[model samples]
Target: MAETIQLVFYIILFNFLLLVVTDVSAGGKMTQPKCHRNSDCPRNLCWPPLVAICDLHKCFCRPQHVNLVVRD
Candidate 1:
């Protein structure tokens, strides 16, 4: 019975998180402070391990700077 309750809780939590993620990325409202060039960013702010990168006419952290989550 406890396992069943746990599973139900997980499912509800998953659905809530899903809605949040969807809403954030839904209507182009997820413009979390993007950049276009190095000069556009603060000096030495995103240096070293997190080099600023320009892509699609925007600047951001290097892909390697972020951790990727993959599931089976």
Candidate 2:
């Protein structure tokens, strides 16, 4: 009886830990939106806004200096 209770407690603890790990990993990874051109993304007017340009059919952003480039 005590052994059964301990087993159930361990199972619950394992599930809770798995849930927390899954949530944490998911929060760290983000999926970028698909795009055909740079115009598909929103323009950032604020200086040094962290993010984003449409490249290779996807919107990609990395930590770096982002300069707004306008082509006629």
Candidate 3:
């Protein structure tokens, strides 16, 4: 019974670690708002590297790291 409980605990721990690894590995993807101001963002502010941008219609984070370029 003790062995079974230990195995179950390890399994749960491994799953949690795997989830954290997967989340950390997936970078450069952020959720932004479709508006112009910091109030539009979920955190009530936009991150420094990503600011608000509105193209007269929809708004999203303006990339601050790289230049405005469209990729294939």
Candidate 4:
């Protein structure tokens, strides 16, 4: 039926929109460390809305601003 087809189409569209939003937000990697509290980040580091994993040892403010130094 036309209604069934329309519903399926809307579902597909919604899924596609979700995928796009996720991709734009996360760029596909999910292992990145997100700050849950102030202790998660060092004093000198500026906490952005989101953080990404730089390597096995550290999570950075972004993919580009790696090797950040934290002041005591």
Best by lDDT: 2
- In angstroms, how far off is 3's CA in candidate 4? 0.2
Q: Write the residue-wise lDDT of candidate 1 on 1-72 in tens digits.
A: 999999999999997875555334333332224566545644443434444444444444443345232111
Write the candidate numbers in order of decreasing TM-score: 4, 2, 3, 1
Candidate 2, residues 16-49, lDDT tens digits: the string is: 8755553343333333567776567555411233
Q: Which candidate gets the maximum TM-score versus the true structure?
A: 4
lDDT of 4 by residue, 1-72 (tens): 999999999999997875555345554533345554424644434234444434444444443344354321
- Model 1 residue runs over 4 Å out of place are 27-72
CA error at residue 52 for candidate 2, angstroms: 22
lDDT for position 24 in model 4: 56
CA lDDT of each candidate?
Answer: 0.48, 0.52, 0.48, 0.49
Which runs of model 4 end up more than 4 angstroms from their true locations? 28-72
Model 1 quality (TM-score): 0.37
The collision pairs in model 1 are 35-59
User: What TM-score does structure 2 among the candidates reach?
Assistant: 0.39
Ranking by lDDT: 2, 4, 3, 1
Cα-based lDDT at residue 37, candidate 1: 52
